[model samples]
Target chain A: MDKTQQSHLLIEDLSVARGERILLGGISLRLSSGQIAEVTGPNGVGKSTLLRAIAGFFPVRSGRMSWVESEAADSAPLAERLHYIGHLDGLKSALTARENLEIGLRFLGRDRRTPLQALDRMELAHVLDLPVGYLSAGQRRRVALARLLIVDRPLWLLDEPLTALDRHACALLKAIVAGHLGSGGLTLAATHEPLGLPGTIQVRLGTR
Target chain B: MTRILLVIFVRDLMLARRIGGGGILGLVFFLSLVTVVPFAIGPDLRLLSRIGPAILWIAALLASLLGLDRLFQADQEDGSLDQMFLSPAPLELIVLVKCMAHWFVTGLPLVMLSPLFGLMLDLDGPALRSVAATLLVGTPTFTLLGAIGAALTVTLRRGGLLLSILVVPLAVPVLIFGVSAAQSATISFLTPFLVLCALGLASIALAPIAAAAALRTAGE
Candidate 1:
């Protein structure tokens, strides 16, 4: 894997809409390597929308979102450089956890670890063979978290990453985010609870 | 790119097989449709042989639409569609690969079983081979067309009926050529069969692009 190089996302006056009704507007933020942007807002405020728009899931109404890398000017499309964990886990419950992660790893490219090792990292090595449907919500969340470890990407877009986690799983996630940030990776998460990590930049939606 | 497409293909295939009902549902639907037909048409052997290919083609076409509404709906609801859009592979190719895998799971079986159903229709050996061959080439077109419908309606609560409606009209050309080619076992089969092939090839090349665009429109 290439050594962690400097990368940053620059968003200016980013406004996103759903159909006619505008969900959020006039949002400006800059996230650089090693910084976490925790988007907070009232329910229905579109914290998820901003992160998703940044992930290239929706068309921005009006704004300039640019990516700057120290290594190259025109880097790969933003999709390949990021990992998006949305409101729903992008997993096939019919497949085992190992199969799920392996499919993600194979599809996402840049395999950093085997599926077993990633699950082991998430304390889910034992449930690797179980169908994801049988796992509890917390276990399923961790299995989804294992996705981050298997594929190496610089940007992590997490939506409600802490929903079903026990205190222990939260700690695991915190440590994982710390490691990712330490390696100069950036995270933009939409969550109600604070990530409990130092120096996390907060962006609130549905305000102003 | 190939790796990503291959995994998607394999994953979809595995899901289709493990889900246990898609293939069987399509087969059972095709069988029931055929079984119910002779009751209406009566057991006139000559009449049945003449119209056997059309009956089989219509049944297969409807059955191909059976499991298609779930094609993108499952992925959409599970959030896999968003992740898929985020993949480096082009969405059009991914859509194509998905439809191809879906056909492998659902459409091919109907083709494989057409001969037995043809026998029930009292079709001769040449007609049996023609039905199977035409269906083998023709079913993928149905799936490709249905995929476009599936992607367009991925977000609706109950899109199955709408999916069939949207797909069947567009599928008329495929149905026409497929039935014609299958019925031409005695006459020069090459003409209609070539048209069927062209229609299939054209849909294969174009349906994915339209489906991918629809998914993008309905995605967010």
Candidate 2:
């Protein structure tokens, strides 16, 4: 392992377990800025669990994980550089789409203009003020992804980011992933099928 | 940090006001409880005077607990709780802001309304004033102490009942001093009022840290 290389995330022999059940065993991976990595695996093979471990959602059973930025091991808290979008959209049902985006940006220590642009990019300008509960499933997925545009973090851990999205939304997401990679922002996305992402490395964990 | 706390507090307080019907319902419940007591105990003016303060304080505590149950429910569901944990704001400051906001809406209003309820209970002017004064100072302590229980039981599905079970025990001292302060107006009034104030100050200082730690452990 090249410990001195500038990697955004370094996971060494990381093992995850739920009680006695081993979800991932002796997994090692490194993520560097300006790259995109996709985790593809069968159901219950711990793609989501691996992402969670990298984001520090839980402690690794017998190994270690470290996050770095600019060749320096970043010791800032989770919010400073990591943006995690889990299975749920994390939107408020009662609030309008715009309000949800604004609140999310505030929580991430950013402003509103970028989120609005992201919503516009997703063709959601018309429904900006509509309560998210009224939006279609694909629209809700876009709203969740718009979070990626609002904050300028260098690392993204997306779990099923394309779930419930349509063909157009999927294409848009592909372009967004490309842009993230071009900006030197590392992304680790979990998906079941081909995302058409440019030069993405696949890590198939089950029995690999 | 204060801004973040204010945002959390204001957002939840406004939502509770608009959606949960906490403001109106809490007052109505307190009113009914106070109004029904005279009928149950019979209109013995002396007995009403003797027990009125205790009854009012108890009703207010119980009524406020209704809204307190929902304090963290929305945040827990919407991933906001996790985000708050990730925030730089000390968990204790966040918990304190939430408890203060709860008091402002639920307990503070009850303080202002106590005098009106006292009048219905045939309380004298000085005793009614005493009740208002004591509640004004004591309700924050009640809220802060109750918040510890709220934070502890937030993860439980049927938490309101459990919150009462946990909180009612800790709130005993506040209830004692609050009612006593109101009742003692007929004698001297100064001693219990000062004691209530002291209890409020102590709770203001201590309860936030306790509630924050309890909430983090419960969430874990």
Candidate 3:
């Protein structure tokens, strides 16, 4: 296996709150390259909130997170090195699948693969020209998933990535996650279902 | 940075075009405001001409707000706004790009059609030219400042009304200077026009920062 130098992410005693309720508290984790952390719990367990905190979507009420590239502490903006897919799918209703993928890659400043190639990898080649709003829920999820492939970011924060996926699409997702891990990348997924990837670390969250 | 900005700008323009309502809605609102003023004031051509600049500025201001709610609302609903937060480009730059795109789609057409609307209100050559020119320079400031309000109200369900309330007060100076520039076209148009430009330049520099901060807080 051709392995690049690993990146390290450390979170210490993280806490998140919404209004008067504490969603998560005293959470800590360390992830390096080629690692996958699966956040599993029932609904309203802060699985999504934890992922959002790591992706910098929500404020961390306490504690800190540090990302180190190779041997040095990387102070570059987290967004530059991470790709985040949330529950909304992020597809513009008027745009085609290909256009969404292309614009998404450009917006992220990643140009590794063409939109067509990325959609092809997601088995969306046949519907490349159709508007995303016209796509089914499963198909739209595939298009969003295709963004992870088009952009070559090291850290992927996926919130319920498999929610709308069918059996075949779920298999494709597993393959993609595995392939991403094989190439010294990090994935933090918040899902209720089993990710079923080898050597994955499971972090279960519950109401505080 | 330029490439990313261009990509966002182009994508927004495309969305505005395909979505098929924002620009047209603003233009139609502008047209109705122009046409209705004659009826409301009983077809007094001189009176219409006298208040033409104010009417046009008022109409333009209201029309600009017609689609302001959609500025960030659609992106927030569809989750592209969150994706935008993750872009390497600073959120301020993204806000700037979105504002520019909004101006291009909504403001530009209103400016282009203002002269015709001015003619309807019996504005002569100098008056019409001044109105168009003022709109060309002033509407960008309107859109930029309005972007902040839009960002602030993006998370709300009926944000359109609140957006107008928030934006209209901030727009008072632009309205005053814009109408003044048109009224003084026969005198020293340069002075008020220059002031309008200054306000525009200031808004261009400041609104994006404020709007980006509002968006971040709203996300939180």
Over the true interface residues, superposed, what is the Cα RMSD of model 3? 0.9
Interface RMSD of each: 1.1, 2.7, 0.9
lDDT tens digits by residue: candidate 2, B74-191: 6666666665665557778888888778777888889888999999888899989998998888778878888888888777778989899988888888888888888888787888
Alpha-carbon shift of residue A138 in model 2 (angstroms): 2.6
Reproduced native contacts, each prediction: 0.71, 0.11, 0.78
Q: Report the lDDT tens digits of candidate 3 across residue range B24-116.
A: 988998999888889999958888899999999999998888888889989999889888988888999999999999999999999998999
- Give a tens-digit lDDT track for model 3, residues A123-162: 8899999999899999999999899989888899999998
Which residue pairs in candidate 3 have backbone atoms (N, alpha carbon, C) closer than 3 angstroms, thus clashing?
none
Error of 1 at A145 (Å): 0.9
- Who is ahead in lDDT, 1 or 2? 1
User: TM-scores for chain A, candidates in order?
Assistant: 0.96, 0.90, 0.95
Give the candidate order by descending DockQ: 3, 1, 2
User: Mind giving the per-residue lDDT tens digits that candidate 2 earns over A1-208?
Assistant: 1233344777799998766877788887788877788898898888988877776555567887777766465467544567777776777777778877776776666453666697998778888888888999889889988887876677888888888988888888889888777767788888886777767878878783
Going through the candidates in order, their DockQ values are 0.77, 0.33, 0.81
List of clashing residue pairs for candidate 1 = none
Docking class of 3: high
**Error at A42, model 2, angstroms:** 4.4
Q: Which candidate leads the pack in DockQ?
A: 3
The TM-score of candidate 1 is 0.97
Every model's TM-score: 0.97, 0.87, 0.97
